[model samples]
Structures are given as C-alpha cells and as structure tokens.
Target: MGIKSSLSKVFASFVLKKIESWKFNAVDAQERTLQKLIAEAKNTVFGADHHFHDIKNYQDFKERVPIRDYEDLRPYIERVVEGEPDILWKNKPQYFAKTSGTTSGVKYIPISKESMPEHIKAARNALLTYIHETGNAKFVDGKMIFLQGSPVLTEKHGIKIGRLSGIVAHLVPAYLQKNRMPSYETNCIEDWEQKVEAIVGETLHEDMRLISGIPPWVQMYFDKLSEKSGGKTIKDIFKNFELFVYGGVNFEPYRAKIEASIGKKIAAIETYPASEGFIAYQDSQTEKGLLLLADAGMFYEFVPADEYYNDKPTRLSLGEVEIDKNYALILNTNAGLWGYSIGDTVKFISLNPYKIMVTGRIKHFISAFGEHVIGEEVEHALLSVANEEGVEITEFTVAPQVNPAESELPYHEWFVEFSKAPQDLAAFSLKVDLALQQKNIYYFDLIEGNILQPLKIRTLAKDAFVNYMKAQGKLGGQNKVPRLSNDRKIAEGLKDYIK
Candidate 1:
C-alpha cells in the first residue's frame, strides 16, 4: 500500500473507534473481526488453487485487464449448459437464483456454495448497519416484507434449492424469521403470471413495517393493493407500515407521487444491490446516500466515470477514492470474482470510504441529439423541480425521444405516477425545463429559451407498471422497468401514456 492508502486505513480505524463509543453500537469489535476476514478473502481468491495468484498489491496489478461482462463466461456456461452438473464453484451447489436479466438474451447467474456467503454477509450487515445507525430493534419484532423473487423449488436445477429472495431469508436470525411474512408466491399465485397477483393479495392482512426491494416491483404491489381495495391506496391496506425502504432505481423521480397516494412521506431509503453481493445500503432512511458495508466480505475497486470504457481505466481502492467523484467499481470478493468490473456508477457522498450515493448505471446514457444526457444530471434536474413543487411521486421512468413528427425540438419525456395534480401544468413543465437547462450546458445552448421543450409528467392509471410488466412478459421473478430508458421501443410503448 502507498503512504496515502496507509493513512486512510489509520484514519478509518481511528474514526470508527469514535463511532463505536455511541450508546447503541458495537462495531469496533466487528472492525477487528473484518481485518481477519480480509486476510482470508485475499487467501481464498489468491491461494494456490484458484486463479490470479500473482499480484501481491493493488499497484502491482495490471493497469487494465481485458474487460468482460457476464456474457464472456459463455465457455464456462457451456460446460453445464445441458445440466451436466459440477460447474463453477461446485460442491453440489445448493440452488441457482434465476434472475431475469437480458439485453441480448436471457442470463442465468449461477449462485453457488462459495458465492452464498457473499449474499449472506451483504444481507446480514445491511441490518447491522441499520441498527448501528438508527438504534432500532423494532426490526427484530415486527413483520418485514421482502419485495423480491419467489422462494419456490427449482425443477430445472433439480435441487432442494433457494431463491435469491429466500437465500437471504434463511440467513436472518430465528427471532426475526418468526415475524416474516410468507412470500406472495407461496400464499396467493401459483400460475406464475399471477404471482404478483398473489403476493399483493397475501400482503393484505400483514402489518408490514420494514419493507425492502426495488421501487418498481413495490409499486406494482401498491397498484394491486389500490385496485383490490376499491381504489383505496396501499396505506389503507397496511395501515401501520411506517417505514418504506426502497431501492434498485431512482427514488426521487417517484417520490412525490408515492407520498401523495400513501398519505405521508414514507420513511424511505436507497440501496445498491446485485446477485454478486448486496454492495451498499442506507443506514438511516433520512440520510442522503447509502452507508456502504465497507467491512463486508468484498474488496471494491472503482474506475472513474469518464475513464470506465477506456483501454486503461483508472482503478481506485477503498482508501483512494474521494467524495462527489463518479467511479465504475471493480470487485474482488469472497464470492470468487477477482478484479471484476460491475457496471454501476456511484458518487461518494462523504469522507467516510463506506458511504456513497449511486448516481446511475454507466450503460444508461443517451447522446442521440448531440446533447449527452446521463442519469445523474436527469435525477438532479427532476429532484430539484420536484422538491420545489412539493410533489410526491411513487413510480416514474424517463426517456429521451426525438420528435419524429414535431421538427422544432427533441423531446425528453418523464412518465410519472403522481400524488397531486399541479394546477398549472405549463408552470410545472417550465420548472423542469429550467432545472435541466441549468444542469447541462450542451442542452442549454442547443435550445436557448424558446426552442427547448419542457418536460412532460403524466400520472399513471394505478396499475401502469403492472400493465408494462404484463406486456413485456416480465410479470414474475426479478422484473423491473428500466428507470431510464433511452431507446425508441419503450418510447413507442409509452406514447399513449405520455401527454
């Protein structure tokens, strides 16, 4: 390690000691335990039996290894393509988490025995972080609703298996397990398409307190709740649900609408999670960014946002990264991924190496009209206007569409499900325009005052995301709308809903 990196570790140790002095926390001991675990992590990934054993330090590692996404593992995937068994991280791997992700085609990420701890550590510490920060033991007593995939058996793998949804479910303490609600699939829907239909139906009688998962799927449940209760909002069904923790998308876009329908500002929190690991989570719902689980069994490396796709992408270790700078992360974990480039981008929100705000995915950007548009700028612009207007939104998606019919301007449409209707639609639209114009100089210069079009926000008809999921055949498992889609296919799909 370099002098600066060494200095960062010393500072981290010192400050954490101070934090451990707080009345409710006991993490200083956990920090010492983590030091031992890190040594084990290095040994496991770099030991004689595994791959990439050469590098002893971060600087000695290659400046840029040939980048590969999940598709690059096709050769390894071919080994077990016919259910041949004993593939990556074998030992009769308990079960595979069937995550529904595709751009080119369907991707089945195999979560094996060795990789199991990665998810477990992530989920366990997620709660530990919440307790350390909030001092709330209510989570130990009350019902926690997991807005996630099914907990059913897998015939394909032929294992008495676990889903990603319930793998984390099995790791929690037995005390907390007693209070959990059975999955929506177990109680309500067996017909697959109707799984969402059942999960929402089963949640009707439960007193949900701390709910977790993506924003869109939760919205799908709330929409169903509204319909089943004769247009009554979800608050009507689960009257005592005070904590509303959501993530996996930009929460700011739908903040106003969700709040409006729910009758109060649901204590919300954001998280950054993946099949690889639960990377980061919010310690307090009121905090600005997620308090990253730094000591979790993963070594994180970040490549700057501007530098990600380059031949020599810059990589920063935990101690080397700075606040407010955007970086694409590389991973080395207990999960057997080394120097792995996970595709998400995050901006550090504070001096603490463990806290960050996920700004956007590095893949989700639009430059169709010579105006480069990214998720962070769009989120900032929308949040500025929404905060100003005092709007409460629960679900929304954004896109950049060139107006084929209208020659004057390229249109940026924000399809929103709103809590309140603004009396002056034009005024609200203009506010969104001003927020955008101030943030992007390319956009500002391209269309000065008159030429630039204002944003269009439209309220969904209760079950809009549900309708989208049904149309896309993504009604079950891990299906969520891309919070920002810059493609024409989705734009055409939303044309009727956009006003």
Candidate 2:
C-alpha cells in the first residue's frame, strides 16, 4: 500500500477501537458528550440565557431549554447572519450551509469552527468505519469522485454562504483532494446538465474507484459515465470502482436503476449528515441501520412522531429511546443549535448500539383524512410493490386529493416517475394502493368504509421529476422529492408533466 493508504489504516484502527467500546455503553458516552457540550458553551449568550451553568444533567438541561423549530430560532440565526458574535455560539461562525427544507424555504444553518471538525471527523469515520468493518481499503489507493455542489462560495453578510456539499469540499484533506476527480472549475458550473457533461469530459479516462453523492446526482454521473464510455458499465470503465457512498435521500427507490447502471452489485454505505450536524453512519457491514454517534459533540432528543404535532409532546433522551418507535429528531449541537428540531423522523432498530433508520420528515406527511401516512410507510409500500411487481420507480410523490369538485370522494394522489415503466400500469397502481392499505390501518379503514376513494396513481414521463426539480431550481445536491404532502400541491404541480 502507498503512504496515504498506510496512514488511513492507522487512523481507522485507532478510531475503531473507541467505536467498538462506545457501542457497549452508548448511554454513558451520550451523557459524557452532553456534559462536555454544556461545559464548552456555558459562557455563550445562548448558554447564559438558558441558564446552562445551573444545569447539572440531562433533566436540568431539558427543563431549561424548550424544544424549538427553525421559526422559533430564526431571530438568533438572523443575528448571526448579521455578523453577530457570541449570539448563539462561542465564536463567529465561519460559514452558513444553506438548505431548502420542506417546511422552511431557505435555511441558513451555521457551521462553526467547533462543529466543522466534528462534521469532518464523523464523515471520515463513516468511510473508515466501512473500511474497518469490511476490510475493503483498495478504493483509497485510487481516485474517488465526490459529486457535490460548486466549491465556489459566495460571501453572505460577513460569512461565506454555499451548499453544505460545497462547504465540505474545501475541508476534505489535501491528500485525498489530489485523487478527487472533476476539476474545481467544472464543479462550479451553475447548470447541472452542463456540469455533468464537464465532469464526464474530465473523468472519462481517470482511475475512478469511489463515487459519493446523493443517489439521484450520482446516478446522473453514472449515466453520463456510461454514455461517454459507449455503453460500458461503470465497472467496465472504472475497473477498480468498489464503493458507493450515498445519503441525503433513501436509496431503495433508485437501487435497481443504480445497480443496473453500475452493471454489477457493489457495496453501498449510508450516512445521516445534515446542515445541522453529522448525526450517524453505517458502522456495521451486516447491520440493518445506522449507528448514531454517541460522542460526536452533539446531544440528541427524540419526540415521539405521533405526538410531534401536539402542543406539548413527550421528549426523551438517549436513555429513554425505544426500539421500533418513530421519533422526530431534536438536536443540541456544538454548532450553537440548542434543542433544535431538525425535522427528521427516525426509528431505532437496535438499542445497544443506538442504530437508527431515518423514517421521514416532520412536515412531509399526508394526514388530510387522518390516515397520517409518513415517508417510511410510503417508502416501504413502494419497495414492496416494486419487488413484488418487478418494476423500477425512479422518483415519486404523494399528495391528498381532498377537493370534492375534482373527485367524488377524497383520496391520495400519487405521481410516479418510472425509468422502467411497468407493462400493466393498472395492475401496478392496484398493487401500490393495496400495499399502502396493508401498511396503514387508518388508510385501509378509510377505503373499506368508503369514506375515501381508492388511491389514484399516474405515471409521469421519464425525467418528469428532474424537470420539476429543475424548474424549482433545486435539481441537485441534497434536494429530493418530498414523499408526502398534506394537500394536492405537489400532485397538482406535477399534473402538467403527466404523459
């Protein structure tokens, strides 16, 4: 192995030692982490305002700080954006990772110096953890492509503003930067179609062994690579390609297409990184869910998903989390976010290791008729129907059709973009409706009682989702279709693109 590979091995070995131990006592690790965070920020304006010094433990901290959403914290974030120091964090934030969340239009999340290292380390360990668990390090010896947003940053107020991906590009270690593909200039190309072509031109002949990005964008890269290489599979062109590092959206919907594009089955790693903080990663090769970071300079709280919309929901710490129950995630991180609801819903599959699978988003759900269908249920239903019917659905969105003028009874409306359309479209729609009915009893009751009509499904033209996202100017990098919406907004918007 080369010097860089050798160094990586050493670091992985050292970090894995702690990870192994922490899995046995994640509660203790979480407690210690919370204490450390409180101690570190005790003197900051937010800390003092919340009486952080008076807090002794988790209970005290929780009692002092009420759970807050982005809207509740907007005043503080605005202050920080105006170049205010020590307003929320101990120091002035170096950058703001801008993201358009489902509920919030454009959010400027602070990225502090203290939080930056934590983000970087968690991401590094995610890859290293995969390597340690699987003993697959060859990808490190060759070039890797990280399909992120532009590395070019724009100054906002006094701090730099850019997509989280772009901000992270500059933080990648210099050694790996040497082997990273797609020139910096090409990455900054505003038009995604133009950028993909630029990437294809530059990396067509390079030794690309690893690729990382959100699944949709990476699939675009894989498609471009295949097109440029004259129908050769990615494996055929980059003979050494091994690992696909992906997150930002669930990979199930695109798995068939991605595997088909790659021309072979390859190992995939999932991460739970957000503009708020680096939360979790897949640490075990065989395990089902991501292992939540216990000592990662962040404190976590879980509000039961069902109670999330309530005026006063029950919030629990790491020790109180239960297996199989969906909870809306709340984070108190080193980035100066205190009791911030990041809007993500998760379900823990393993308590010992604190492994969780992201279930959905708080704002992204369909409960117009009290069916309360979530992203997790929609994803599960989609997977079941896809597997049973042997179809490939690239992207999909669901919204409630509640207008009596349009339909006799209220029903769910589904708009699907299929790369490989099913031959029997009616049968496919029936299967989707049946799967959702089976998964959600309330939905089933609504249909059985004739209170709501059967779910409506419409297949969209290929690239319909791409076109829709492009029209919204959010076609790439962490932007994804919100699986469920309360009204017919998404479905109505997509109607114009129906085939």
Q: Name the candidate that leads on lDDT.
A: 2
Q: Once model 2 is optimally superposed onto the true structure by TM-score, how far is the C-alpha of residue 188 displaced, in angstroms?
A: 1.5
lDDT (0-100) at residue 127 of candidate 1? 56
Clashes of each: 13, 0
Alpha carbon lDDT at 37, candidate 1: 32
lDDT of each: 0.61, 0.88
Q: Which candidate is the best by TM-score?
A: 2
Q: Tens digit of lDDT per residue, candidate 1, span 1-499?
A: 3343244345444544544452122233334433443445443313333323454455644432344566665554444434655344333345555554555265445555655675665555555555555544444445777766555555464544445665566566554565676553462343444665676667777877776766666666676778777888767777767667666777767665566567677666566777666777776656677766555555577888888779777777666778888888766544444466667888888754357888777777655666666788877876777777776555557777576355666667777656555567678877876787798787787667544465666656555666666777776455656667667666567656544
Candidate 2 steric clashes: 0
| Cα lDDT tens digits for candidate 2, 89-195 | 88789899988766677899999888889889998999888877777788888988888888888896679999888999888988788888788899889789898
Indicate the TM-score of model 2: 0.97
What lDDT does candidate 2 reach at residue 115?
A: 87
* Model 2: per-residue Cα lDDT at residue 5: 70
Stretches off by above 4 angstroms in model 2 are 156-158, 404-407
Q: Model 1 Cα displacement at 315 (Å)?
A: 1.9
